[model samples]
Target: MSLEVKNLVKKYGDKTVVNDLSFTMDKPGVYALLGTNGAGKTTSIRSILGMLAFESGEILWNGGKLDTSKINVGYLAEERGLYPKYTLMDQLLYFAKLKGVSKEEAKKRIKDWAEKLQVTEYIYPPAVKGKKAKVKKAEELSKGNQQKIQLMAALISDPELLVLDEPLSGLDPVNADLFKNIIKEEVAKGKYIIMSSHQMATIEEFCEDLTIIDKGNVVLQGNLNEIKKSYGRVNLCVKVEGDIENLIKEADLTVVNKTPNEYQLKVNKEEDAKVLLEKILQTNLPLIKFELREPTLHEIFVEKVGNVHEE
Candidate 1:
């Protein structure tokens, strides 16, 4: 399934959450949606999922409006909603059934996912304190485990499209790795994924295309690498021994942050780096290190958000 959101708008009284947002994604690939808190990320997701009625917009499954009454879509919210009183297997099978999966198929898929996620041991609820919770009613598991259940709820049905919101919210590094590998495998199988996250490292590692919104407006969108390159205004930090200030100065770089012995140069036009490097070598400055680095996602975030915070 494909998603096409066009002219989306949402408001609460005087406050507009999503302002005429639009985007199109087809085929199987990971798409990351990023924005600061209260920047309409959630609103947009909700609108597309048919959870909220937008003032005016279009959400299409393939090329037409989404048939909320018929589309088989799965959603995993950041705030997970799992019955703590239900056994993991029972809960998952319930969701599977809701998605129209047969009992046999749901059972097989649940067992397969449990093993894949290394949570087969958690199939039965653990004892929290003194009382023993029955199979029909159990409430003992870690928050991370609950998140895993949420992931399974959204993924077990094997829907054509998966909408995961902060899917790794509670996972540690190891679990995060496992989750990413699973997401990758799903992608390889040609399942379209739309992920919302604040973790830039995760976004960098997992997503190919991304859309960044600020103040209810999209400031950047497209392939991650291409966006980084085209966004320009990138500063490359070079650490080489000796004085190459004159050469760097000759490069006429902007946003030049420097110390006596080290130099950080911002190349608005990256082509100038080549000319700058040639000048540095001519000066016989000890070229101990010469590298070009893209701006960190944090930097990009601040630029988009327009609020600098202490690092």
Candidate 2:
């Protein structure tokens, strides 16, 4: 199945928050919607999921208008959506039932997900010898654990289409890795996922295609690798036992960053990097590291957004 958002436009009275945003997921895999805070990423996602009204645009699923009521879809919102006073188990069951999952099936799925998310104790507290077991309430859990429960609620239905907004935002490192593994498993199961996160490394690891917006405007959209390739391998990183400040100036390379142990430089072309490499070797100062590679997603994001502001 394919998901397409075409020329999506959302405005609040006089200001447009998402302007002509468009992207397509032709097959099952992760598609990233990225932007800075208030850059319209969340608005675009809400419009696509039919959670918010849009002034203009068509969100199509499998070549037809997307109707959440008729299709199975899961969403993990950036803002936590849990009843602070409600028991976690009850909330999960309620969410699952809303998605038409049978009580027995919902409980089974909840059990499995609770185990996978490492929140079993909250959902199914160990029974005290003489007391009734009590399920934990949303407010009782830490933010990270609450995030896991929200994810569990999203996955309870095993939705064909999943939308995750900053899925790892408040997660600890261990839980973050757990979430990543679950995402990988979903991809392996051929699930269609649309993820929006500020984590460029995570996006680069999972998404093959992405759309980056800046102030409601589409700035960059395409296959991630192709985007990086278009920019070319202009990034150069080197480390040596001794200083190479003069060598860098000699090669006419722009230093992006420099520390006592390493130097991050920018070269206009591959040959410029080669010139720097030759200079370092000639010094015979124990070249520790010399690598030239494509600009990372973080760098690309900054450059694109920075350019937009400048324009």
lDDT of each prediction vs. the true structure? 0.79, 0.94
Top TM-score prediction, candidate number: 2
Q: Each prediction's TM-score against the native?
A: 0.83, 0.98
Clashes of 1: 0
RMSD of each: 4.2, 0.9
Per-residue lDDT tens digits of candidate 1, residues 1-311?
57898899988888888888887788788888899887889888988888998899899988878865577777889787888777778888899988888999988888888788877767754566877844532257777777777788888878777888888877899898988998899889888788999898888887888888876778777888886766674677777787776676677876357776667777766688788888877877677666677776766776767752231
10 residues in a row with least lDDT, candidate 2: 127-136
Model 1: weakest 10-residue lDDT segment is 302-311
On residues 113-232, what C-alpha lDDT tens digit does candidate 2 reach at each position? 998998999999988997998778999999999999999999999999999999999788898999999999999999999999999999999999999999999999999999999999
Model 1 vs truth, CA RMSD:
4.2
